[model samples]
Target: MSAPLAAVPALTAPKAPKKLRSETVALDSGLTVVAVRKPGVPLVEARLRVPFLSAKAAHPARANLLAEALPTGAGGYDRAGLAAAVQALGGDISVSVDADRLAVSGNVLATNLRALLDLVAALLVEPAYARPEVATERARLVERLGMARARPGVVASEALARRMWGAHPYSLDLPDGDAVAAVTQAQLHATHRDLVRPAGATLVLVGDLPTARLVEQAGAALADWTGSPAARRVPALPASPGGPLLVLDRPGSVQTSVRYGAPAVPRSDPGFPALQLANLIFGGYFSSRWTENIREDKGYTYGPHSRVDHHTLGSTLALDVEVATEVTAPALLETHYELGRIATLPVTEAEVESVRQYAIGTLALSTATQAGLASTLSALAAFDLGLDWIAGQPKRLLATTVDEVSAAAARFFAPTAFTSVVVGDAATIAAPLAALGPVER
Candidate 1:
């Protein structure tokens, strides 16, 4: 009863174009300011990055405590007063402490940028380091550390870091419950004086405001900020003590969490970009080998992937996935097989194009807002990269060849050096996984 219909061509949507440009200004005080000017936006985001944090300090948690404590009360304002002032001015301030850096950042309306900058400078240079606030925050951190220990994923990650880096400070677990309880206000103050030095730190400002004006304001705001001469040094990460499997037993787990990876290139490694692209093809995306093999084809887990954890001193290629307990071993095997495939087989031209498109397309999304642009610029400055680095990303990603990707995969993904971490019933899976490599209890 139906007439034959002619086949219609499929309509394809045009790819979205990329738009965004950034500029960087180097301040006289060794501070680097980066900014992006966008049309029709009247907001500015400024972030100040101090290079030393938990990893570089004599007492790491002290830096952690100070970051939280600084914003509570500074200059002549009490904790409540500071909060009210920021709220009334329609601005927000936050402090973040990570392994390699501590950042005090804020967002403000373009009209109120100067006041916000003044407030941030006071927090940094004129903090009273109120002992009462320090005691309160330290108590909260101790409680948080206790909660983290009960988390399976947290336990697995911290264990992996410890195993991978041994005694390196980077591997130091964030203060445990007992360690946090032992930290004192005096120690926090001493740690602040030692690591948060101007010579080793950099101030990064990113926003749409005039660069010259911001630099001038920063100079006046932070003029008296000085620190005792000291250089922070991190112990070298030992070569991955590659061996067998290590598993942490989370007895009641219905789903097994797995992390398998090995040491890879650092941020400064010349092969960083190539390795980054190569990883994108392997497991860095939703359509990558690990996803297709471990999830789609085998149905072992929801999804699986890998990332290059680019640290200041070193980096790692980490693959993580969650699967049913019964399928954990097979899923890990599939992960390793996928890793080897990129090196052993020639990658298809189609796959290369697909990944290149994905990488560049996603990057454009990352710079969509003023805050986003500022964050990107801050990262570039932290890595000592130039403004052109952003513009060159698309070209570099597209120019990678199959041969180059294969070589990069081979150089970075070594199955022998691959360390496996399974957070589930070690009693149930340990014997089977041990056959793959030596089993570390």
Candidate 2:
């Protein structure tokens, strides 16, 4: 005879987040600095966020080159000399850019915090953009972009963005290789002058130090780097009209990539917490219904995920999955089945409680370290959010009712609301997929 297994334990609610001491200051030069005293290791983290969005068609290539060239040489040092200076301070630095902003982020020894600030100031105010350095980065960027476009996932993402945002700047996730090759050092210098100024930007510092002293150090270092970027309006996100599935051809691909998207609420919306929880229950986690059905039960994919992607202009609910080409049609069929089920039926109390605990626990874990906290705060700075919003999220999650989660699921998870795309061997997938719905070639 075999013994019966014991019942699983019930989950307890998450505790309130710990309060940390922090300060914010706006300097006369139009920069916002936020400092937080989180004593753990003997290190500090820094993030500089500058608004980089533009309506110009040429902005993407110039912005890409400028981000790559920022740390190559600045002030009096070349690339190697700049690296040596930062390494001598027990630090590391890197630059990155996207559709919305350009960010320079790194960490350093707590005692050398002021020195790191000085280096950042130099990079912002006096970048050299040497001819040789810019030429090398431009070639490398072109090659990298060529390689990226060859992948199936990149092709599908580009198609989805085009369908979702139409002619908006958001549609162009990666710039054209020809445009990147055409960028000149002079153009990059002009881009730096126009978009990389300190005005309408923010700096975040977190580590073992008094908040007030950290703000003063930053203020003194960045005082001279001041100017407003050229004014350009970000057009509102166009409505993502749901229609026939768009089938893009990638000849001889063994796997099929499926992308589906719908409109979603931002973090500031009153219904955001419930919507977040609902997404987790649907496909945001490994234990979610969509994953359980498509991956575990049907063996269609290794995993599938859904999430709320936030942008400055709007937010979207996105779902992504890659399955074997032979199973493409069946996979999408099961996906629609699951979406329809969740949107029409009320979720159980157990499901809601499970996701709530997961959400709160993950948030607490993400902010437990200094680097993590610095990055989190910097991303939130785009929306004018700070530590107060982070500390108060657990309470909001605890108070959310099962009814709220169900309502949110019904509203956001409806299958009819999605704009879907599939990238695979059109010869094999087109007919079967067309049987499910109207598919545009």
Candidate 3:
């Protein structure tokens, strides 16, 4: 009395919404402002990206201290004063820096949008990196870094970054504690002076508002500020330490965290759509073949997922899984097995459609929420893109043929193309992993 799974009606992607009323305004200070009106929620989300680059002596810790200390005091207000002022306007704010740029984001009721803009713009104009406050934030950051480094998942991803990026600033996983402790308020000020500038920044506002008014508000708040020139370039990435097995020794550990990845393309690449679907079918979802084979069948990991991640500097196809220390090698073997199958086999149309629906449905859901739309648009701004491009994504996925997904899978999903590192008790699992392939001590 039930229809066969194959006989089930195929899933359809949601219709693309009409493009938002949008405009780009170039402020006098050289910051590019993108505004879009969605007009649903009585709320507004604002995202600011100020360019932050690494120096010859790269110190992520120093940059982080600068990021953390900004809100403690800015625009003639102490840290608590800033928090109180922002909260008074029904808003919250956060700041962080990566190899590419420094990000500042916050949300507020639509009625308080101007107040939020004023506070953020003021910080940009005159950040108070006071000496005592810098010391306070520095100590707390160092303590948190120690706890983060102890987790195997963190350990493995940091290892992946190191193996993926050699000598480039991207390779530094966490900031050095001693380096952090040595960071002075003068350094934070210096970093801000050299980096955070309006000319090198992009600000995005999305929610219920007029695009022109949004731009006007942004310009008024930031008009007097100045930033460095816009000619800065990200250091070109070096070649990945090619497909090799790296084993990191973590003594007396109960589980192994394995991270595998390969260089991939960015959002601008034409192949991005097919590659995204290929990733979905591989391990981007719980029902993906990689998950069905390893997590559901073999019970090697509770969470096994993959993604095609894009950063300003580059992109990668990466997946991670955790398994019992004793089964570390087995888990890696199965991961490769699934990867090989996706590369060589003729995938069923049904499999392709299933992933297609999930991908499209997720995009719709993510953009439906105000917070999600703001985050999505802000992330796109990092790549010099905007909302129209994202609105067309469901079409691109729909246009992907079975043959195309199959070809993409073969081209990008091959197991042999990956470089990986296993983090666990080297004494217990090193020999077994070594027997499987080349294992670095």
Candidate 4:
């Protein structure tokens, strides 16, 4: 008790630099393939990305149906046969339909890579889109819609997408129970024929496989797949018309869910890196401006952050925060203030450095795994970026000047263009929020 002890400073280790190994293969069929052969893992992941999806196709919903229907039966095998084959090989295949693309992916042991590729080839080249399976899946989608409506978060997100995109086909809602009920087997087949094609698709494989063998196997498996002339370019979305704050009333919500943002740059935009850095300083990290001001300082809620969603249709910056219902207006006001501050003020050198380090370090950590590497390539393919984008990242990130960050903030973080979405008791916070902008009650 009589002796005073000096405190020891905690040791912080420096982050290790990232090593990225990747190769891009261009197939004679015009399918671009990207692969990453990392050591220490015995598993391989293959991702096939097609740029055409529900939004661009004649019947957008069919894109999703066709993607789902493919793995159910292909290469003369029924749904059960395909399932048994994958299970026996100790592998799994899944499909996802996004606004800009459709992805079919599989993970298998290294030894079974050839078999997995054969399975994927059959799925892509020989889907039956059977009527019975289409009806069953349609019923399942109807159930999913019903379940989605019951979740406040899902409802808010769906509503936000609709409000942001307006009449754009991308805004096409996930079909509701009634809409699902209306979908027919013939419609599914017709959509499949229109959207899933060779001209607008990419194939990616990542794992510890020889490049030569992979190319040979993939070529033979996918050679028969054919389609019409690919679309020269992706459709553009109109600027999000900035307007009133939209508040969806969800009764008994203990926490007020918020989504506030507007259109931002696409992945291919020159300002992409700068905007990414600027957004990190704003709310992309745990210790960002939004978190420091809105949560740490005021104790408004648990956390807040923002992201740039790069999609085939377009891109947008999203600021998401959840707070107690009573403090919703204050939280929103603080968020807007922080956004405006980034543009108007010159960020301190320390803040700028911190964000850059955080972003670069995260990138390194993300590409450390085979699956992670494949995912990175898939995103690049979707954005039409080159294979060298990863290698070129350091120069671009380090080259970001404070002035560029400020300019990016000014260009993309305009508060006037932001659309506010709150899922809470509209009766409680509606009036207070309207004073800041028009209210879409």
Please tell me which predicted candidate would have the highest lDDT against the true structure. Answer: 2
Judged by whole-model lDDT over C-alpha atoms, candidate 1 comes out at 0.73
Best by TM-score: 2
lDDT of 4 by residue, 1-441 (tens): 688888966434344444545667777677877766666688888888887644443444565566566677878888999999998888989988756677888888878887888888787777766788878887777687789788766677777878877756666646456765676777765655666776757787777877666666677778877775434444567778778888999877777889876888876678888899889989999999989998899999888879998766678898887899889889888887987888778777777777887877787777667787777888888777744776677567788888888888888887886876788888888888887777896
List ranges where model 2 is wrong by over 4 Å.
1-8
Which residue pairs collide, candidate 1? 244-438
Alpha-carbon local distance difference test for all models: 0.73, 0.92, 0.84, 0.76
- Clash count per candidate: 1, 0, 1, 1
What is the model-wide C-alpha lDDT for candidate 2? 0.92
Error of 2 at 378 (Å): 0.8
- Better-scoring candidate (TM-score), 2 or 3: 2
- Total clashes, candidate 1? 1
- Model 1 stretches astray by more than 4 angstroms: 1-28, 53-58, 267-270
Summarize candidate 2's per-residue lDDT along 1-441 as a digit string, tens digits.
999999988776566666899999888888999999999899999999998999899999999989998899998999999999999999998999999999999899999999998999889999989999999999999999999999898899899999999989999999999999999999998999988988889999999999998998899888779888877877988999889999999899999999999999988788999999999999999999999999999999999999999888889999999999999999999999989988999999999888989999888999999999999999999999989889878888888999999899899999999999999999999999999989999
TM-score-sorted candidate list, best first: 2, 3, 1, 4
Candidates 1 and 2: which is better by lDDT?
A: 2
Pick out the ten consecutive residues of candidate 3 with the lowest summed lDDT: 226-235
